[model samples]
Target: MVTGKAIVLSVLVTLSVVVRTASQLPIPPRYDGFVYKNRISADSVLVEAFFDPLCPDSRDSWWPLKEALRYYKHNITFIVHPFALPYHNNAFIASRSLHVANKINTSYTFPLLERFFRYQQNFYNKPTLQTSPATITQQIIHFALEKTGNSSFEKFVLGFQDKSSDMTTRISFKYGCSRAVTGTPYFFVNGIPLNIEETLDFAKWKSIIDPLLAEQAQAYT
Candidate 1:
């Protein structure tokens, strides 16, 4: 999240108009074993969020994000783009884990991701405590098993370890680099960057988002 006076500056930059609609944009490249959500057809505002699982700031933004989601709900569709910052080794694993969950089904992915975010603060405080990828995978598996009550958790966990997940991780890196996104939690609303300073005072951000969502709502009517 952009903060302090920088928030204003960032929001100003974000509001810079990029003259392209969702239909004009190319289909994002699909990496092997990866599932991409075609958000343009969803009848909601498209929000693409670039995040790192281990980043404290990313975790910090969760409450506000949830509030925003609730405030918009069906009026917005959020697509999470994984940006695994390498310094936090576990972050990449978390991203790949989401890809693995996505492979099985879209419904499972969001719940599991919410679970992961719930534990993010604990995970961040004890980076060394994560042990191995297998350990992390098991933790996620247990969470899924309990939440979904699925009997196939063991098979799913094993599948989650596949090397093919690397492709989506690479795609994330490339997308970030191309967009000049050097930080975690970068966001785009309707493919337009927000201009924090110019367009997003704390009060203004919600005002801007609400009207765009209203426009999307009207488009459907």
Candidate 2:
């Protein structure tokens, strides 16, 4: 459930092109799990990551985050939400494509995400400044279809052009707004926002997540 005030603030976020902090926004009313549940008792941690498909910072975070996930395995439940920043041109297309991928094949979503991050440079403001939206759409369609492998091209295009894609992408943005995620790569560990000012590595992430797992293990006994 989104409040009127938060809705208004999220609108204001798009009026500017620069990425800004949204500390003033109220904490969202709810945060149900997007992926796996907690590791232990009520006091346990749930890792939730909000990302923009075309944001570089979000791309940088994925490496360390993936490494940490590999190390922790089933000991953690990490949820990923795509929060496409408005300032980045065609970001909505990429984000919407994610939902389309999920509809076609949930398993393809991760591979599609990796492809988006790797090729983000191609879709940036400057590179695509002269490019038309139709052309970009085709590029995205091709990229996504290739990732989906045997997925029908017709279905891919149909899903991409569906109104539901836009709605789902907007829902993702609004969800991020509810969480006061004003910028890209917003992360919350156990509902507490992580400081991402510095580059994060597996060690840095482990320093935080390892303890939570340890505490959960201690309590499980």
Candidate 3:
């Protein structure tokens, strides 16, 4: 019998080939404000993540990841790429919505992602089995508008339909593929992929980050 993980992996591999056949897309932009803020020094550790918006693992990882990003704010640079897995029914639309949020306002990116994580259950395959794509898109837009008050509804709707926004989302997915990301909540630290199989926690994050930060503090002193 095919295991659940095997089935998911099979679909992911097949999807990767399909994406490779399509036009190559850019590496999704990283949050660059950290550089301008003088937050990143030569010693700063870079943490990059690829997440599926409707993925349960991604949602579970968000809290611990956010904590590390916050507590080590000055010592690390964090970038996230939204990768929509083929297995999740609305993952593409939700990921596309993130690009639209960024287009509307860069600051809206993580907030919208966080909101997606919170409301992810509603968009799961079973729950949304009967839901239309248009309805799903509207729900995502509505959720986005709720957290970020006063954002233009028209712009959000239009952005959703724009080719560029959708391309960017697919680009993000393809970007993750280039990195050989096979599953949700994949992570790399300082360009090295973390082969973690267990749940990530504060202690585990510090285990990787603190030593690097310590060396940085020592080197600068």
CA deviation > 4 Å runs, candidate 2: 1-44
How far is each candidate from the true structure, as Cα RMSD in Å? Answer: 11.8, 8.8, 8.7
Candidate 3: segments with Cα more than 4 A from true spot: 1-42
lDDT of 1 by residue, 46-122 (tens): 77767776676666665576677667666667777778887776777777767767766766666666776777664
TM-score of each: 0.67, 0.79, 0.82
Worst-scoring 10-residue span by lDDT in model 1? 31-40
Best model per lDDT: 3
* Residues 49-142, model 3: lDDT tens digits: 8889899999999898788877887688777788899999999998988888777777787888889899899899999999999999998888
> How would you encode candidate 2's per-residue C-alpha lDDT over 86-132 as one tens digit per residue?
89998988888888877776677878888999989989999899999
Identify the runs in model 1 with alpha carbons over 4 angstroms from their true place. Answer: 1-43, 125-130, 195-205, 213-221
Please identify which of the two predictions, 2 or 3, would achieve the higher TM-score against the true structure.
3
Worst 10 residues of 3 by lDDT: 31-40
Deviation in Å, model 2, residue 145 alpha carbon: 1.8
Top candidate when judged by TM-score against the true structure: 3
TM-score of model number 1: 0.67
Scored by Cα lDDT, where does model 3 land? 0.82
